[model samples]
Target: MRKALAEVGQTYDVVVLGAGAGGMSATVFAALEGMRVLLVERTEYLGGTTAFSAATTWIPLTRHSRAIGADDSREKVSGFLDRAVGNRSPKVLREAFLAAGPEVVETLENKTDVHFRPRPFHPDYLYELEGATSFGRALEPTPFEAGELGADLALIRPPIPEFTILGGMMIDRDDIGHLMKMGKSLKSAVYSARLIGRYYLGKMRHGRDPRLLMGNALIGRMLLTAKKLGVDILTETETTAFVTDKNGVTGVTLRQKGIDKRITVTGGVVLASGGFSRHPKMRTEKLPHPAPEFSPSAPGHTGALHDLAFAAGAHHGTTSAQPCFWAPVSHRRRPDGSMAVFPHFVFDRSKPGIISVGRDGRRFVNESTSYHQFVSAMYATNKDGSHVPTYLIADAKALKTYGMGMIRPGGANIKPYLADGYLTEGATLDELARKLGIDANGLKDSVSRMNAYAKTGVDADFARGTTVYEKANGDPTHGPNPTLGALETAPYYAVKLWPGDIGSAMGLVGDENTRLLREDGSVIEGLYACGNDLQSIMGGVYPGPGITVGPAIVFGAIAARHAAQRAAAARRGEAGQGEAA
Candidate 1:
């Protein structure tokens, strides 16, 4: 207690690793409670991947929505989580996050300058699917003035440009329905345009630079809260390990360039340094596939913290590393040295893409459920050594639409892919079948039956034409089953699909309380991990829109508060012991 109190500025009450969603919320809450905090990040920015994330946070119901009359309840939230993440999470870990998420949401809204608004348009994935709810109880960060953050803004990353935003001309989901409901009315259109126009004019009037994209809005909002709280956000500093004495964690070691330095912090460390999804060796050994599809996680996602926590004697669990829930991107390069990937734009029967086949050149599983399901099934035959490249059979339409985004329409950038024979097109299914090395008869039989079902909006085999989500999301013009249009139109195409992963979601197992455990299931002292470094509580499945993020924030806060409590208790004990001695 004498040493800890003497360590003041040299050691904080809490040291949080990583500046991601969980870390951000944890630091803010800890600082507000009057705990001295230090947040370390390896990037030049805060937000981690959250800045560029989908900006959609999934909570069954939030105070903001409830205030606006949305029918949401904690009971419903608990029931949904039970069905979703289930027993995969530690009971303590689950309860802590579930209980704290709503409070965190409400706290950020009222106490901070953050702009959090309920997203009325955000849908729970498969919401319209049988047994799903229509009202998506979620919130998004309102567009922010990126410049108000000052130099702290340097610690923030930008959002992906392709997505919709209020500052830009693109139409978002929230506006699409309003436009259709008020279609062709000049007053409505003008009014909508004016609302958007007002935001831009407002930003310029405030003398603030704007990066008001959807995901950026959330990043911008949180950073505002962080700045107001005066929390020190140290970026471009790499954390090599957790420092500890026999008592508990003492501080952290940080590296800049090649120079090494040790900082003693009295506050316990929060290990929010994400997962090993982007790690090279982990990618090679544990992931099902050989590659990644445009993960937004920064380049620094090595297995450092996973290894750090393990070295610090954190208990291992589930005995596996799982792939991220991702959408497969059919990617191609543009002239600007940028790669444009269209997510889950696989070709249907009417369109052209590689014919996705099982090892026997047979189709299995509805290919469009979610990319998580798609990639998992892509490697289903790996144990038998028969699955290599899952073939993509496409015609001209597939080539035209697949890799052509982010380039000028009819531009010369596509000439190389076509010239190098990366894309194949043919008039006959037999020749295309031969090119894909499929059994001609089997391909024919499969196509014939699939076409028959396409004519009637039915998938007799795997029930592919089942959901309106599929129909609305797919090519609606294809008719019948938009997902099952006939490939008889000719100009066939094929590309082999590789088993790929976005990142890993598995790691040191913890109970729902967010405590790091030892190998024998005993809890480790003064250690905590959240975000990807912690084994996912969701069992590596996509249960909602912002699964990784919401819990990350929830558990991150839970860990920080608990760590502070532990520190306070230790200080009290030490003072008492000293007096008695």
Candidate 2:
């Protein structure tokens, strides 16, 4: 139903679709190799799901680890991958990812504005897994100032507003310690003052402060590096279909501003559209019933590249038992009629005095496990969606100390939350149960049992505070048990949680070279995929923090290098023909 309004005959050495971490990384790498590159994005702003992320990259046995005094080896990481990813993982792909990951980081940091540091205390999601380490495998981007981006700052998508403070001020894990005690301690007060002062100063210069951190920082640096390397970036351009010859894919037909145009590519096309998380048809086919309502992914993500690749004869990869990486999300509808969905990762769950319960008013999970593990329990217990609205119950003291969902710590006013219907409050356990439509007697008995556990600093029912992973997420200062506390306060509170997915698990089939493959296992020359578009190397299991972005960056590098070499070879062949002529 659309018409071609124009055609672009310019042949780029490499054309990258989507501007997420993967696509951006590929563009930067290819440009660094002197390839005539073109980067296109469906959205006006760049940085797909990655911008809203914590921006941690889980890369094992890297130079960063070595610098941090970690003694990890490739063999150990491989053993861990084998045990964690199981038979569903491709051995060659896994090996390639691990091998290329450290190199990618080294090159990026050595050549461009991209920078990272080891998270010395960060642990794998399943720390107890074979060969898993307690630290040094994860790396986070160095925080970047928005002013360094200049005019391009507006084009970098900011972190989720729900993750920010006082409107748009972004803070990282290090800022939490100071913020939690800002009012009580002088040093914390000075730290908070300095942060606020910097934020306001930036606001005075730019309409919004450009003090980018986390995922935004990673993408901001990538964009700047790409620009410096002379990569042409086209925003609001949709790649509708691939232009293929008998030999292989040669270019792409793009629809931009409602006008279709064809752009030739001599190098290759990289598919990194942040997966099919938002596509209705794909959601129907790949996800469970009652499609997920909230995703931390960029709004532009709708699996367009996947559809286009499939139309071009690319085969679907083997599906995972788990089609998506899961997380529990809690939302509050704002006065502007927009809902703010917050993914509960490391903040509130493992904190003392909080428990998650189902419709039957009983604890269904440990409530201190990894987000993926917690959501898995949610699915197993609430089959058929009977527990449409699960509640996270906590007492007044807990709410004041730890906060719930979007509520910040340090005694934030809860009256507004209650008035907006975001929180259910009751003076007593019975009152709260009645309001939440749960069995009052069952909730009472559950609370009594949890209180007993709190007294002894032990969770006999679901082992809430047993694992090192749980304790790591907990408040170490809390006495008795850092993650266990009695709910014996007068006022109790509850917030509803819904199952949400952070990334897709299934995608186009690809080989160790990041080349897309056909049904017969033949490679599609000049076509590559990475990020969520390539079936995750870990299959369905979430091995550790930054797994998604870590492999995304590595394959992005792989795809770019391979395409650049191929294009150079083709150019040489053409030059040879000219000499013969």
What tens digits encode model 2's per-residue C-alpha lDDT throughout 1-581? Answer: 01122433368889999888899989999999999888888887899989999889998887889998886899989999888888776889999998888889999999999999987688887777778887779999999885866778888887788888877899998887898789999999999999989998897788686888899999988988987888877787888889999767999988878888788888899998988878889888878767678775678779878887887789766746577888899888777897778899978888888888887788888888889878877877776675656789999999988898988775478789898878899999999999998888878888888889888988999887776777888889986777888888869999988888898888888999899999988889899998988888989788899999999999999999999998899899989999999
The TM-score between candidate 1 and the true structure equals 0.80
Residues 515-545, candidate 1, lDDT per residue (tens digit)? 7878777776777878777787776766556
TM-score, predicted candidate 2 vs. hidden true structure? 0.96
Give the TM-score of each candidate.
0.80, 0.96
Q: Which segments of model 2 are wrong by more than 4 Å?
A: 1-9
Name the best candidate (by lDDT). Answer: 2
Candidate models: Cα lDDT each = 0.62, 0.85
lDDT score, candidate 2 = 0.85
